[model samples]
Target: MINKIGKITIYVNDQEEAKKFWTEKVGFVVKFEQEMAPGMKWLEVGPSEEEFTTFVLYNKEAMKAQNPSVSVGHPSILLSTTDVEKAYEEMKENGVEVGKLMAMPYGKMFSFNDQDGNNYLLREDK
Candidate 1:
């Protein structure tokens, strides 16, 4: 049986930017790195508050499972943060395009897109 959403793979056009944004800016640790396939690179960023990791794959074969060629679907990915405002402001200051904070019936959320145009929703943890 499936245990949980193990990992989310995010395809990136720029490895350097993705590494910087997910690591330095978002506070995720770089789990590992190596050559994914000939010219492609593999860098996995671990979740700051959880036991999950997001893969930054470049090779076509590695990204093949993400269907229709999209690694994610609607709402793409949801990352939990302690402070949505601070996270939003920090990302914005870094020239990362993000949406304004909005209060939902569940919690606060702000959207942002990665270097690959993959959308992500950042929510505050209760």
Candidate 2:
């Protein structure tokens, strides 16, 4: 049985730019990177190098060419943080497009967008 989340695939117009946004803005580190072809690459990023789950930044155009029926839109992802306030402030200070924080029934949470306009939810892990 599958017991853990391994990787999440996110399609983007430009992989390099997406990598920069995740690494520089979101503070994720590059977990892996390999050339898939002459100009395409298999790139992965996560909160830390030791994290098991990763975000796989794939090329939208290439995926479309490979499989016309493949969905290239971004997936709705919920990320956890120990401190919502600090995360919100850090993301804002890093120039990330972030939404206003709110006190949800579950916890304090907020949303942020990547360079490709992919939205992700960040909730406090209390």
Candidate 3:
């Protein structure tokens, strides 16, 4: 039987920079980190220590070299927040590239980019 989401893999150019962006800018915590191999590391980060799912920041070049069949692309991740405006403002103040907030019948949402330029949506459900 299927359970909840385990982890999401995000291939990045620089693991350290990505880690800083997620932890410092995006306010994610480092759940786990270890050296998988020489010049390769396995890093897991999430919103909090108690969170179930995490984002695994993998070394893109190393991963691609190890697995040629690996598919690396931008993933549309929708993050829920209690206040979309506040989240957007915080992200912008933290120097994160953010898109304009949009209002929809469902909720208010905005998009922000990580250091690696991967865009993620933040929504405040009404």
Candidate 4:
């Protein structure tokens, strides 16, 4: 049986660039990176200490025919921050394009867009 939601896969244009963004600013750790089928590259980045998330970006043209999502824009990478205000501030300080922090009925949240136009949500209930 499926015990939990293990991983989510996203496509990006530049693996290295995405890796850096996810790791450095987003606080995930690189788990594995290498090449894949048909001259395409594969990368998986996540939090080293705990289980985070990952996205794999392949070269655009090669992946385009498949209508892979990355060719159009970045892959969504959602995150949860304990302190929404502080988190939004840090993102702004780092030059991250984040939407104004908003409170939701379920929780507090803010949307952040990456270099590639992908929108990610930062939410907290805890």
Candidate number achieving the greatest TM-score relative to the actual structure: 2
Error of 1 at 31 (Å): 0.7
Model 3 misplaced regions, further than 4 Å: none
Q: Show model 2 residue runs off by greater than 4 Å.
A: none
In candidate 1, what are the lDDT values of residues 1-126, reduced to their tens digit? 986765666666567777887777666778778885666677778765466656543434445554555543333578888888888888888777798899989899998877656788899996
Better of 1 and 4 by lDDT: 1
lDDT of each: 0.72, 0.94, 0.90, 0.71
Per-candidate TM-scores read: 0.74, 0.97, 0.95, 0.76
lDDT score for candidate 2 against the true structure:
0.94
Residues 1-126, model 2: lDDT tens digits:
999999999999999999999999989999999998898899999999889999999999999999999999778899999999999999999999999999978799999999988899999997
lDDT of 1: 0.72
Ranking by TM-score: 2, 3, 4, 1
Measured with C-alpha atoms, the lDDT of residue 99 in candidate 3 is 96
In the range 1-126, model 3's lDDT, one tens digit per residue, is 989999998889999999999999989999999997778789999999999999999888887788889888867788888988988888998999999999998899998888888888899965
What would the per-residue lDDT of candidate 4 be over residues 1-126, giving only the tens digit for each residue? 866655666656666777777777766787777767756777777656466444554545666767756445455556777788888887788778889888878888999876666788998858
Query: What C-alpha lDDT does candidate 4 achieve relative to the native structure?
Result: 0.71
